[model samples]
Target: MKLALVGDIGGTNARFALWKNDRIESVRTLAAAEFATPERAIEDYLSALGLPLDSLSSLCLGCAGPVSGEDFRFTNNHWTLNRTAFRNALQLDNLLLINDFTAMALGMTSLRENERIQICPGEAEADRPALVIGPGTGLGVSTLLPDGERGWRVLPGEGGHVDLPIGSLREAALWQQLFAELGHVRAEDILSGSGLVRLYRSICALDNHVPHLTSPAEISSAALAGDPVAEEVLSLFCIWLGRVAGNGVLSLGARGGVYIVGGVIPRFSAFFQSSGFAKSLRSKGCMSHYLEGVPVWLVTAEYPGLEGAGVALQQMLDTPNAA
Candidate 1:
């Protein structure tokens, strides 16, 4: 069996799938809290499917962490994976590990026309670069550069930890509060799921209200239900997302457009469409004109990382150094 196995390992959940050719044959997910390591999660997923691990011909893993040499230590989880151990344990002929964001960037090629909602309208130059950023356990960043032959090259980035700039007086005050607590604030500090809660707490504190805030889901739900405090927090999140994305766009010169992916934005797509995201994106003083013409899209595809892992696996197989 020419089987291809792909995994998207996140902090809370690990999604595993078996792919034949370009289509997924079977998919399963497990709670990260239930497993002690990536190997355990993979074994459990395969066991549930009644499949033998030896049947896999090619394996690719997209982990939510930095790939250092041949090993990866997850940022949000306690799993530390060594490529040698993974290969030896699985007895696989070929195995590849890539950053989850890079896998997502590779999967962009397979995105359907309707799977992405264009947030900004502009002329797309086929030769220009495309951007991808998502907020999940943390912020994931990657770029797709045109290879000039109907192909794109995926470049994974660590842009989430970049210094966050204060955009407004409100944002500046929030930064002061955050800085007082954490001393340093990164983009992830104000743009992730946890960041939404932090923003909500900051707003509540600023308004002299009790700082007893709920989870990110509750905040989103309340915002959708017209709660002023939740709405204010969500609005700030969206605006900051736009500002950070615009910074990425400027740095990449991504005239092909930007794609927003992850588990966060899908929940508030309607509110995001109406939020000050576009306004914040185009607010760059001198470079406002340069960014105004760039298009932005929100990726609405389910299992995007799974598809992206498949793409990454295929690319590895096609590369000369693949073994």
Candidate 2:
């Protein structure tokens, strides 16, 4: 049977799947760093599946970069994708390109009630916007705007690159040190997996203590195991994440609530719930009361972006100009 191809390409991993009549089949993931190019990896995946590439009619790709024309380049990687070339390489009739976070936002519509962990208890206003932010290999930002009696329109954003505002003297000192080292401080600087390690080292540096910083996974493990320094790092990370999330909510005027999507938050959901995330998120000086009414939800769906790619493909097919 003819199938639709869907893929979510991120900085570290790329998830590929075959969608047949709204159902996902033969899903697979590959390390993007292991391959020289995205097309080569796709070729390998198709070859391993024993499927003829030419038989697929349409392909939808959600990539970790801004979609520009027929070619897309990853911000955190060296891979560049040419849609025309990819189409020619795979011999597909139709192709769709989308930002990975945009795909995730669209995928929100398909999420089941059970797939979300509600962090706040307010009723969502359908007329308001919904915000989505996530910390993975990198930070992603997007928003769902109401579409005037229709559903919602997803807008992919680069809010992660916005300047990180320091709220306290301690945070300001940390920011100064980070600025000295990295030149510019963005939300992604302290809101992603690598950002966790940076926060740990920076905190340790302030205390004149030597930090044995390692990978994000190692930091998370130590924190979960009750290591004081690691725990401190995780705490700061959660607080800062909440602060940035609050900024996103304000920027979008998202009364529908905020949704966290990424591999990082799922690792320590309990800690996130109990940590300073919520407190900091709602701690805007004069706007605390306003922010308190906005709820937060953790997206717990697996392969959400893949599901989004399917939705995107379907939308594309239904569009009048999508021959």
lDDT of 1 by residue, 130-242 (tens): 88899876788899887776556787778889888779998898888888877889989878888888888878777888865578899999899989899888898888888
Per-residue accuracy of model 2 over 72-152 as CA lDDT, tens digit each: 788687899888788888778788888899889878877889999988667778888898898987788899877784545
- Report the error of model 2 at residue 146, Å: 3.8
* Local error of candidate 1 at residue 27 (angstroms): 1.3
Model 2 residue 259 distance off true place after TM-score fit, in angstroms: 0.9
Query: Stretches of candidate 2 above 4 Å error?
Result: 33-40, 76-78, 148-151
RMSD of 1: 1.9
Clashes of 2: 0
Measured on C-alpha atoms, candidate 2 has an lDDT of: 0.85
Query: What TM-score do all the candidates reach, one by one?
Result: 0.93, 0.91
For each candidate, the alpha-carbon lDDT, in order, equals 0.84, 0.85
